[model samples]
Target chain A: MTDVNSVRPQARAETSVRPEEVLLPPVDVIEDAAGITLFADLPGVSRDRLGVHIEGDSLTIEGRILLPAPEGLEPIHTEVGLAVYRRVFTLSKELDPDRVAAEFNQGVLKLRIPKVEHAQPRRIAVQVA
Target chain B: MFYRSLFPRDVLAELDRLQRGMQQQGDVSPSIRGTGRGGYPAMNVGSTAQSVEIHAFAPGLDPASLDVQLDKGVLTIAGERPGVLPPKEAPATVHIDERFSGRFRRVVTLPDDVDPNAVSARYTDGVLHVSVQRRAAAQPRRINVV
Candidate 1:
């Protein structure tokens, strides 16, 4: 397991100007022979409010949460305040950026990034004498 | 290697003590006021004139799997989120595993004025919203001067 603290420095550097709180959504990244897949937990973010963009080696994910206050209700007790979620990852060149597939359901976002043809492993056959 | 496992428990206990000390200093976040426990799935509690609303910020949990219960005045939320990787296959090399997946339960005591019979809950996107109506006597009434 990659230490959660290790990934924060890079993401924090990317969003230095924002005065509002920028949450680092918890994520799971799995890498296999084919490629890598990333799953991010972004509760309260709807489909239209989510944004995923790749610029060169940097991959940034942003989600806006809209929480409407119920009518005629004065908030007596408040805890979890609303804030936008943002995170950035530095991607390697071996991953094919154009072929990425993404899906959002419930409150999780899944992104699949395939490896380039040359980056995929190939088995060789043995020749008989 | 054996010592590493034992070391964390001591470290964690120390950290907990330090956090408690910090909380006593009045620097803790107000939202976590009643719910003293920390880590995974933070929550918010709010109240209107007629109802009390609790918003649990838990994502990636199946809606049907969540268990919500109200006993006396305390509300309990329990659920589990299965790990993303397939179990049968060889473990894929993980780059990061910050997302926690396991059984979790959070219980918070509510005020005595809430009406248990008039509770409603809904799960949308990834938030579990639980609203319980308050008893008539608990609501604030405007006084008129003749």
Candidate 2:
């Protein structure tokens, strides 16, 4: 119980979110034997407004969504006022960050990271005597 | 080691899911101002001097699959977001699944001054934008006095 309680706060602060109102976009992570894939939903964000960066073992994704209100338009109804999305993750040492690949479409970003050769599983052949 | 086994990453993920569910339930209170609680594809409506613009932030949807309708003074946006999860038999393990999927629909009641026939809708970068022109008489105009 002590171990769980000690780790709970760290897990909640996994993304290192700031105090300001920053929209944390929902994300999905899938891991296989080969590598891991991450998917983030970023609606209203264009390709030019998105930034993905990797330094050391830290991975960051940032995007800005600016809703265009034509001149003389007054907002009569508003639900979502969020304009920025930011998330960060500490990659595992077994993953190869240099080979990361990313793709964006329909406001969704997909990132793929492959495992290092030494970390990948290999089937060894046994000699029959 | 036993305590470590007791609280694996999956347990934390389950707790996160539960927290999100609770928060969403809290947002479902019905309001006359039309703010949806925990609704998919959140929307915003604004009016200009000549037109009313409605924007729905919905990603991961095909433009052709979206259905928009304007009847009387109500505008409806309906669409389906396909699930991106792996199959049960796949060897992959999903650590997180937070994106909203499946079918969703949002309805907005426009003002009486809008012209139903002059409405136009378009989908770009996963956002559905609908613009409805207001009636010419409803727009404010200046008159010169002698």
Candidate 2 CAPRI assessment class = medium
Output the number of the lDDT-best candidate.
2
> Candidate 1: which stretches are off by over 4 Å?
A1-19, A71-79, A124-129, B1-20, B27-37, B86-91
Estimate, for each residue in B15-123, the C-alpha lDDT of model 1 and write its tens digit. Answer: 9999878876764454453544354567777777888888887888878999999999999999998887656467578888888788888887788999999999888
* Per-prediction TM-score to the true structure, in the order listed: 0.80, 0.79
Candidate 2 residue lDDT tens string, B9-76: 99899999998777667555645644474588888899999999998989889999999999999999
Kept native contacts, fraction for each prediction: 0.76, 0.86
True contacts kept of 2: 0.86
DockQ of model 1 vs. true complex: 0.51
Residue A109 of model 2 has an lDDT of 93
lDDT of each: 0.83, 0.87
